[model samples]
Target chain A: MLDAFSRAVVSADASTAPIGDLSALKAFVASGNRRLDAVNAIASNASCMVSDAIAGMICENQGLIQAGGNCYPNRRMAACLRDGEIVLRYVSYALLAGDASVLDDRCLNGLKETYAALGVPATSTVRAVQIMKAQAAAHIQDDPSEARAGARLRKMGSPVVNDRCASLVAEASSYFDRVISALG
Target chain B: MKSVVTTVIAAADAAGRFPSTSDLESVQGSLQRAAARMEAAEKLSGNLDNVAKEAYDACIAKYPYLNNAGEANSSETFKTKCMRDVKHYLRLISYSLVVGGTGPLDEWGIAGQREVYRALNLPTGPYVAALSFARNRGCAPRDMSAQALTEYNALVDYVINSLS
Candidate 1:
């Protein structure tokens, strides 16, 4: 029930990070908090974002929405969307925590096994996660309203290559890569 | 197998819990040393066959009695087994190095060692000697960085310590 900020703080309490690294983590967290609006944006739009993405995937894989497919029934379709949301939520936790282990252990560790057992098509699920990842990264790093602006222009106005925000963004994207690989 | 440290972190993560400061440090350290570890792993892995042959020759020279009748070193199977074990340990070390973590070498690396040896009617001493020689000779690569060498030694020594 804790808000993402509270959750991030709570996760930060138990750490063996060295003095300097702890400071770095603290700074990163502070900077991340400034960017909390992205998480907020994603949270606010998650359902529609997930549904639209999955609908596209389902549309392309026409057989899937037909009889006896992995997501044949409307109920299965709903489950797929729900699972996508769950994955997104956990990915957000890892983004805030600056660690991939959370996503790895909770969401992805046995997912392939579970999917196999339940007959979920991994390819569709992977595509869905990829869709979410792209959307989330866009929100985190860019303003959709300013679609014409180059992402580089935004960076040019700020820190250099070691830009903390850029680094965190890369880290966040890596989580998506991790998830995609796990599902793939 | 996963590193013990990563496994523990995974447990904490599953509980939706935060990390202890040490855990953060550990994970970050792995990230920092990742490149060097992978470098060392590449060097060792690239020379796997050569290292095995060199280590085997050295072991035989040091303990000629192992080549006697009824001894493990005398049989082609046991000799092959020695090569196989070397490859296994080296491969595991390479994984740990590339991953920048000292995985549970004891659990996945050295575990079942005795059973394998017994099954092959192998002597522990010669096998140990050959492994030590492999580590010693294989690690002598001049191109490896100090950090890479340190990381390499840490993993191989960890396996040796567990066994010896």
Candidate 2:
């Protein structure tokens, strides 16, 4: 051990790293930002994303429109829908920032209490977030022949941003997991 | 049940490296906010009796049946338990304020509380309302930064959510 330590103390190769190549690092960062931009593509139609998701949730749970349910009262329905939009807005923020704290701190920090105080339904809210997650992932999946997100990324000159698209979708999906678990 | 230490360790465990500079900065931010929280807690720590009294008074005013002496679950017993809980919540909030997180409340106090209240046939509304009273009646001392106040409100809301 003493011999090895003496050898290491005398070694320049072990202490010094070659610093000529940076393309790999640059490519990594560029790809990461590209994936982020791909995720942000879903941002333009955020209202549609949230509304469609909530529409699906309300469809599955029709009781939400009936008396005594959370969405039954006109004001209650507005609040429910507004909250869906708020959640999606925050989810988008998290996705774009590549961090969950923005969503956790701003929108979800006291959301449970606010929901309980307003008698908002947790189960329905959970489902709405899930639906949004699915829809957002769909928007990230690249399509070669249309009916998918292929045309969206075609401007970047890649017919197959396949793995990149898949990873971006995966990251986007996980942010909603935080929301679901927060409500859970 | 997240505190600065647990949160940093978890992040490091997730990424398999030292917690990054951003993580350290986030901790610093929480600690900065915590100074305000500590001051707020100190203000409330000395005034527990007055805070608890006003909370009970406000709750009784809102729900008069709580004033009854004859009803078993509806009046005296419920009032006593409710007031006790409200007092504990104020103290718990004080503790949480100093800790700068809800870790204490979730781990030590509120876990599984929803079911406990349900099993006891306790009305959650009264408890929730009493908590609101305790905080709004100035148990959450007025001289707090907006950031500190938001953190305090979040903990109170967390307790209310657990009950409801």
Candidate 3:
């Protein structure tokens, strides 16, 4: 699922490589912009893999905040999904914009809000957003090749899935596990 | 929770006191624990967590930058250029090694070499200074600047030339 989104992100960006003369390259890039636009649309739809993954994990945990077999909001498990959706949307937009530099201020701000709302630690979450932004900035000087950009998007997704976003998922699941076991 | 958080922050700060290896080793234990707790609790709120998370997120988000050998290649080129300058500068001052005739080469006689080495030494002092400052100030050495490298280069010249 994540792999598909990764491919979509990479394929969406126009290549910065010089294929012929300067004019030809620009023309190629201009023409490719439409393709990139299409890719962004595809990316928005495809990135649901992240949310789905988190949701499934929560379900597997017996619904941490379950009320009648469904996880209730405000519970740790539900909070994780909420946070995941927030981050996923932000990340998807950033990727769709085809510019990672735009992520720091906007994305980080949203992350801070989510953490505050979920009663989770905002420290790592904020740092994760900042790190994500810095990562994007570092790539500003890079050539906009689909392969290169896609590789970066994919790499960036790990922190979302494993560290920041996924970390929340795992944490919620663990708490649910503990509560369920303790209750049993 | 606050106590654990405080300890972790202090440990992270203190870890900056030693050399890179020790600093990292010292912090890793506390940091890992703190990180785990934050992950487990899903309730982290502190400046330290903020900064660490920022760095972590930045690292994760920018993972692609690290994968690109091209950036590394460019940085290496920059490093090579700087080193080349150092070598050239070093050779220019090797004349001092020959000037060693009586009581430590004086400023009046071998002043040019002395000055060159002194210029070089200025940079060297900071690398040493930066490490010391990082220890005292409690931070990472890489947080120091390239100016430190340049300073170290100068200090090497000063020590070499002064050795007679």
RMSD of each: 12.3, 21.9, 24.7
State every prediction's TM-score relative to the real structure: 0.55, 0.43, 0.23
Which one is best on TM-score?
1
What DockQ does candidate 2 have relative to the true complex?
Answer: 0.01
- Tens digits of per-residue lDDT, candidate 3, A1-184, equal 1111122222322241111112322232233323232223323333343344454455445534456332355565465555444443434333322233223443353544554575554333333333323332222212224664575443222121112322222322332232223222
DockQ-derived CAPRI band for the predicted complex in model 1: incorrect
TM-score of chain A of each: 0.74, 0.73, 0.35
DockQ of all candidates, in order?
A: 0.01, 0.01, 0.01
Clashing pairs in 2: A143-A150
Q: Give a tens-digit lDDT track for model 2, residues A1-184.
A: 1111112212312432111232332332345445445544565556677788878898998998999877878988787777887777666555544457656776788888887897777888999999988877766663333655464533324435556477667877888899998887
TM-score of the candidate numbered 2? Answer: 0.43
Per-residue lDDT of B30-120 in model 3, one digit per residue for the tens?
A: 3333222222112111122332334333332434343245432136564344333333322222211111111112322234754664664
The ten-residue window of minimal lDDT in model 2 chain A covers: A1-10
In angstroms, how far off is B43's CA in candidate 1? 0.9
**Model 1 over residues B1-164: C-alpha lDDT tens digits?**
25423454455456644344454455455455655765676677677667767767777787888778987677898778767666667666665664445543454567787787679676666556666876665444475878888888788777777666
